[model samples]
Every structure is written in structure tokens, then in C-alpha cells.
Target: MLPLLLVPPALSTAFALAPVRRPFAAAAAGWVVSLPALELPVHTGIGVAAVTAGALAVGPVTTADRVGTGLAALTCGGLAVVLARHRAAARVLDRAFEGFAGSGAVDTTTRTTARNRTPWPTVLLRPWPVRPRSIRARRGLVYGPDPRANRLDLYTPRDGGRPRGVLIHIHGGHFRAGGPSRESRAMLFDHALRGWASVSTTYHLSPTPEAGFPQHLVDIKRLIYWIRTEGPRHGIGADAPIVVAGSSAGAHIAMMTALTAGDPRFQPGFEEADTSLAGAIGLYGYYGRLGAETKDISDPVRHPADGAPPVAVIHGTDDMYTPVKGSRRLERHLRAGSSNPVFYAELPGAQHGFDAVQSPRYLAVVAAIARFTEPLAG
Candidate 1:
């Protein structure tokens, strides 16, 4: 019975550690467990519960039960240490900015706010993060030809002041599926409350004949074009400095947009439009090509042009899908050419989609982004 009790934690730990390559269902399960694993404190509590169950077991507590309890205690202690590190995420992110040119000091205290203070009830129950009411949002504004995929949601502070900066956040679903409404609500709301105009936009997913390499990029470019042209009517200045951010596949698009600014290939109809960016932020991004049909031009690292803007690449060391080495390679390539700061934070024990929730780890990331990009804004 004791060994049977250890089965759940042991399996979850295995799933978190193992690399899922085949069997789509197995990969899906891994992704699901990875989310809870990132909540170290919550996971540690489970271990504690397992130990308490062992202590209360009736009828001749076996040696197996005692061993299971011991193992549960050890897991609890290990997770406690990881939780401390997660709490100190701001400092850890700062260390990553060291030695990068134009990298300024990050004030961790002021960046942390009441918004990041997760209530015990919410944290224990693990609900999806909801957009703050303090943020004024305009949802489902069309940006391109496609009515559905071309729509964008713009967010701003409810104080009714025009935001001088704009942040465009793209969603990540392997370039196949993901919507702007679900992911990154916490970060978007935090930025909006801080007086920046935040825009979350949808794009054409991949594998379809209509959507692929430059086509997806073309849609993003169209969104940028819309921001420059139609944004002034919505309180965003036409010349406001814009920063691009994305997760997973969206990160790849963000990096490409940053590096390939003013390239006619990406902006076929709007070649004359100004698409330059102030900076870029990527969360657990994939740098390589997506499919066999996709060309080398889709590779972000391949097009490290001169005058590249400041970049922030944050990834989890324990990510099962996209490895951390890709981010490391991207940092090296960017640092070699670009004179701007290249902040690369490799979070310990974090999993993919860690930023989807408002965990302590992601709160630190949000603060780091504020420190990194706020200076670039006017």
C-alpha cells in the first residue's frame, strides 16, 4: 500500500524529467503535468499530503509505507529549495543581463506590485489568470483580410491617457494552434496597468495551404502596419515605440520580425511601411524551421542582421518540447553581431508554458521584461 501510494508522485516526476518524442497523447500528458510541476509550492504540498497519509494509515504500517513516507519527505524538501529559487526570479533574471551592452540595472522592488500577489485560495486551486478590470480593452478589432485570424485585442490603462508605448504579444501553439485570448493575460494586464498599450493578436496557423513560412510573418507585418495606421484613433500614437513579444512559435515570429525589419520579402504589399521594432521578448521560443516545406529563411538565427534591437530570450532548463540549448545558441549568435543587450534567462526547474500562468516564476519574468523594455520606450 505504501509503494502504491508513491506511484503518482514517482510517475509525475518521471513525466517531468523524460523527453516526449512520439505518441502525441504521451506528449500531451507531459505538457499537462509540466504545468503543475512548475507550481513548486503546490507540488510540495502534495508530497506533504502523501506523507500525512502514510502517518495515518491503519492496520500494521508496513516497512514499504515508511519508505514511501521518507521518499515523499525528500521530495518535499527538494521542492522547497526550488520554490525559494523561483521566488528570487528577479535577481536570477538580472544576472542574465550582466555584461550585455546597454543593459541597465533592474529595480526588483518597484516592479513587483499587488497584481503579482497571488491569494492563497487562487494559488491552491490553480485557476486561469483573468484580465484585470483596471485595464480598458477593445476586443476583436480587425487588422487584416481574414476576419477571424486577423483580429487583435488592444489593452490600455483605464485612466484614459494615451499610451506612449505599444507592446504586441503573439500567442504560441507550434505555429499550428493558439489564440490571443488565453495565454499571457497576466503579463498583458500587468503592462497595461503600467500605462503601456498592449495588443494581443491572432495569426494564421500553419500546415494549411494558405498559411506557412512568410505568410504567417506577413500577417504579423500587417498587424504592425495596422498599428501604425489605425492605432492613433485608439489612443496609441502613430510613432510610438513598439516592442514585440511571443511564446513558443510566436516567439520565433517575434524574433524574425525584429531581425528582418524593412525586408521587402516579408512585407510584399506594404514594402514602404516602417516596421522597425524597439526590442523583442521571446518566451520558450523555437528558433528552428517548422516543417519540411518551410525553408531556411524561416530560421531566426540564420538572419542575424546588423542593427538588431535588444532581445530577451527566456526558457526553462527542464522544457520537454523546446530545449534550452536553442536559446543558448540564439544568445551567442545575437551577442556576436548586435551591440544591444541580449538578456537570456534560463529558469531552473521550470517547464514549457510556465508563463501561461501567473506563478512566482512568471512574476519575476514580468518584472525583468519591465526592466528590459521600459527603458527603450519613450
Candidate 2:
């Protein structure tokens, strides 16, 4: 009875350890032999030993039951020895490969070349619109805890009654470089001209290894939360609809934030309550299908299962970094799953970053975004 009780647990552990291999065949044969010897203790002991031996030869076994106790002990001991040997072999191979490749010398040359490359030319230009009285410029920190983190320049429309809407602008730097001051000043001017308060935020760059993956995302989310909560004090109404707009990496973060709208990790305040965004606009944004195998997609915030806000995606067909296909894929997925509106526009010969800085063709893309938000703002 005790030996019979052990068979299920032993088989379960074996299957779990060696999912692709069939270890159950040996166990079944042993069980058949044991059935005939059930009456005698000596015969039962021999039968149990046979099954244990078969299990040990096949795969990992658990010792919770008496049937495969010895087999489980031996398998665990063998695994430890095998793991130790693999670690030693890996170290030896790594050292040999490093010596042959001369990694240290190669890395130094690469670093030197990167350092000497010219930095991206950046300039900040503020164009005061004809209605200068309706726009006011002020500098403020989004996440007040971090002093070195990016500061936001807030341009509020001064119509004297209340803000019609708010547009939060995030500047793209490929997650490494670029500041909001230069990349988004033109957009801010446009927003002010349209009588909408605009915010341009600067975030930290990836100069150090620690600043690489998700730190920029955290900074952006913090900025959004601050704007949502504190905009009322600056004359922007609390209930005023907010539109998040970004280009390139900025667009990527904005899309991620929208996808993770109700997730507590991204927005704790919105977890228990409704935190649906008014709208989201992404220019040449990168979007990844869940579970799709791709090297470009990295760590992402947990997305809400409910739904995402209405999104307008614009991408140039010739964009090298975040292709138009990515935006198209997102539009298809969003439209199929929810009632929220998704708009996609593909520009023909334009490359990445064309819409941010003005070009004759890129003006049309900007006009599309303006049109999408005009109805909501009104």
C-alpha cells in the first residue's frame, strides 16, 4: 500500500523534470511486476527497488514516498555534481574565448570612437505667438524628489476663464540623449497658439549603466501623474482633458504609459479607481505585440487588461528605428479588442524625427494630430 502510494508522486516529479522525455514507460513496467509480488514483503521490496532503479536511470524523482526514495536521493546528488562540472567548464571556455578575441583592447577602441563622435546639435527657440497675453512661460520640476531629473517648461494659455485643454509633450532621445528644451519647443508654441496649455519635460539620459532600461519610463510616469494632479494650481482645470504626445522614444514611453493606465506599478492612485486617459498620440512610436519574439522589445510596464485610451499613431514608412509596421500592428490589435478609436497615418518618404522638426511633408502629420484633438478640446 505504501509503495503504491509513492508511485504517483515519483511519476509526477519525473514528468516535471523531464517533460520531453518519456520516463513513465519504465514506471509502468515496474508497476506490472510489483502487482504480482504484493503479498510478500521480500517480493515487494525487490519490486520497489526495481522501480526506483528505473526512475533514477530515467529522470529526477522526489523522495516524498517510499517507492522511489533511493532514486530521488541519487538523482539530486547527480544533478549537483553535473551542475558543478558545467560551471567549471563554462569558466574555462569564457577565459579562452576572451583571450582569443582580445575583448579588453577591442572594447577600449569602441569606447574611444563613441566618445569622439560629435554630439547631436541642440537649440532651444521660443516663438511667442500673436496672442502673447494668452500664453505664460514658467519652469517647474515634475518629480521634485530628484534634483538632477528633467525640469518641465509649462506654457499656460491665459484666456482668463480656464484652460481649454492640456498637452503634455515628451522629447525623444533614443533613450540616451536629447533634451526637451530644443526638441519640443516648436510643438509648445503650436499648442499655445491653439489656446491649449502645453508642458515640455526634460528627463535623465543614459550616461551610466544604471540609467538604461526603465528609469526614463519611471520619470515620464512621474511627470504625467504630477501634471494630472497639480495642473489646477497653474490655471489648468483638474477635469481638463489631457493629451500625451511624443516622438520616437518619447512616443514609446507615452504608449507604454497609456497601455499601463490602470496598473498600480505605473500609477498607484489609478489602481482602484478609473484612470482612463483622454487620448494618446504617438509619432513614429514603437509597439510590440505581447509574446512576440523580438530583440528590440525590452522590459515593459504591466499593461491593464481592461482597455486603453483612444490613440492616434503616425509613422513614416521609411522610419529606420521604429518602423511603420509596428504602429500598424498596434492599430490592428487595439481596434479588434476594444471600441476605442485608433487612427494610423503612414507618410511615404519621410524618415524618423521628421515630424518633430518641421518639413513640408511633416506639417500634414502635425495637422492630423491637431485635428484629432480639436473636437475633444472644444
Candidate 3:
């Protein structure tokens, strides 16, 4: 019984330490393990009490069993310490930016009547775990001559009205394998519900003839230029705000593009067009690429300055794949140099790709996203 009890937690402690290797371990570590860790205070206390109760209830065991119970008890204590780190991170986030959620108010006392009002299912978690069903989406519209690598999707509100904003979501798979249809599960309809159009674009994946460093970014540039120039004809344009966002690899691209602001290298033919972004968002992302190696390279933080657009970044403290330290370093760099506002959230027990689905943590981060992006729209 003691070994059985230890197996579940001992496995998690190891995975949390070691980067995920197996597909099963990836899913469990990416999603399942963080759930309890997010609510670590509650789980840790309950676990210790439960273990004590179980040991007292089932007495008269062999000496080996007793030793096993003691080891299990020690492991449980370590697990609690691990979970406590999550709680500490959450406190750091709250202290850093608590009242700013969707209100922009620094403290509760500064909130106005409008800020006090919260939108249903927008800033708050849905009672159900599922995302709102998508409506009125246009799929696989060709944006460029490259038939295979230049397609994009637009999800619009079913009700015919001009969108309040547009979100361009770039999928992440180390620039090799992800597609528009592969990611942005929770944001698609949620943006539509809030009267915003959602754009998910596919770039030429790596290992292909057309896919290269700035070329992949150029495909995204074509999407941005298309939206800014041609979006109004389809009822999405300068009237509302436009935010470019992405996860991991996509986040890297989003940051680089937004920071460059139509640099000629990334936008070869269409260099004069206004490719400026209203805002930028990156989830569990970093400044540069190549896994913690940086220099005067093709990265965003290398070119920080005043007048850069506002950015909201979310990173998980427990994320070993990308490491949360990168996000923290970028935040410090941005704050020290950039004149624009930098909203950063470091979740306590979250892992890489944590927001693949709707959870308490995901919804809360979405609420922060709403707050950050709302002010961008003129």
C-alpha cells in the first residue's frame, strides 16, 4: 500500500525534474500533473493528512512495509515542498499584477464602475470545461501565390457586424510541423464571442524548399499586410485593434515581427506597407531561439528600444522544456529599455503548452489577455 501510494507522486516528482520524454509522460506532465500543482496548497495539506490517516488505519504490517511507509511519507513531504513553489509563484504574480486584470486598475480602490463589471465567459472561467463552439469561420483562404504555404483561416462572429478587434494566432511546432488548424483551440470562438475576428495562419514548415528563416516570417508578413490592406473590404480593418500572438515557436516569430515593424528583410517586396501591430502576446515563449543560446542574432530582445508595442507574456514556472528563466530575463530587458508597457504573468505550477485546453489557469490567463488587448483598440 505504501509503495502504491508513493508511485503516483514519485513519478510526478521525477517528471517535474526531468524534461518529458515519452508521449504518455508528455501528456501527463503537460496537462494532468499541473492541475493539482496549481492548487498546491489545498492538495498538499490534504495529501499529508490522508497519508497519516491511512497509515494509522492499516497497522500490524511487516518491518519492510513499515520502512516503505516511512520512505513514502518522506517523499510526500518533498512533494508538498514542490507544490509550495507553485503557491509561491502565484503569490508573486498576484503581488506583481493582481488588480490589473481586465480593469487596468492598480488596486481595487482605483477601479471604476466600468472596470468592476466583468464579462461572462470572457474574463471568467466557463462553468463547463469546453470552449464556445465556433461560428461563421472561413477556412483555407489563399493569401499568397504559394498555394500550400500561404493559406490562412478567419473565424468571424456569426452575427454580421464589424469586429471590435482581430487576433492573428500563429501556431508553434519549432517552425517545422504545426498548422493553423493544429492550435488556438480555446481562443477561436472566444475572440468571436467578444466581437473580434480570429486569424490563424500557416507558414511554410521547415525542412521544405520554401521554408527558411525570414521566409516563414514573410508568409506571416503577407498575412499581416493582407489584413491591414484588404481586411476592411471584408469588414475587418483599421477600425479595430490588431494583435499578433503565438505559442513557443510562433511566439518567437510574433515577437520578432512586432518588434521589427516591417523591417525590409522580413518583408522583401512589400517593405513600405504599414506592418505595425497594435499589441503582441506570447505564451510560454522566449526572446530568441536555439534553446537558451543567444547573441547578435535573429531574435527580438536583441533589438529592444523605446516605442515598441505593448506585450503580454505568460510563462509557467514549472516549464522545463523552454525554461521560465528566459521569459523572466526578457521581461527584465524589456522593462529596462522599452518605453511601452510590459504585462508579464508567471504561473506557479504551469508547464509548457499549458493552455491547450480550458482550465481554471487557462481561463485566468485569458482574462489577463482580454485586459491587455482591450486597450489596444482605438
The numbered model that scores best in TM-score is 1
lDDT of 2 by residue, 1-378 (tens): 334544543443332222221244654443333222211222233444566566556655455343446544443443333223222322332232243233221122223223222212211121111225657878765554566665788887666557678788777776677665555455666677787888877676776323454556556666666666776778777678778888877787778766766556554444453344677888877665323342233322234323766777777554555667787776776667646666666654334565433322333344445655665573
Q: If both were scored by TM-score, which would come out higher, candidate 1 or candidate 3?
A: 1
Instruction: Encode model 3's per-residue lDDT on 284-323: one tens digit a residue.
Output: 8856644333345466778764546788788887666567
lDDT of each: 0.77, 0.55, 0.67
Each model's backbone clash number: 0, 2, 0
Candidate 1 vs candidate 2: the lDDT winner is 1
Q: Which runs of model 2 end up more than 4 angstroms from their true locations? A: 1-134, 207-213, 268-275, 289-306
Question: Which stretches of candidate 1 lie above 4 Å from their native place?
Answer: 1-6, 17-28, 43-71, 100-127, 208-211, 291-294
My TM-score estimates for the predictions, one after another, are 0.85, 0.58, 0.72
- Poorest lDDT segment (10 consecutive residues) of candidate 1: 105-114
Say which candidate scores most in lDDT.
1
Off by over 4 Å in 3: 1-94, 98-134, 208-211, 289-297
Clashing pairs in 1: none
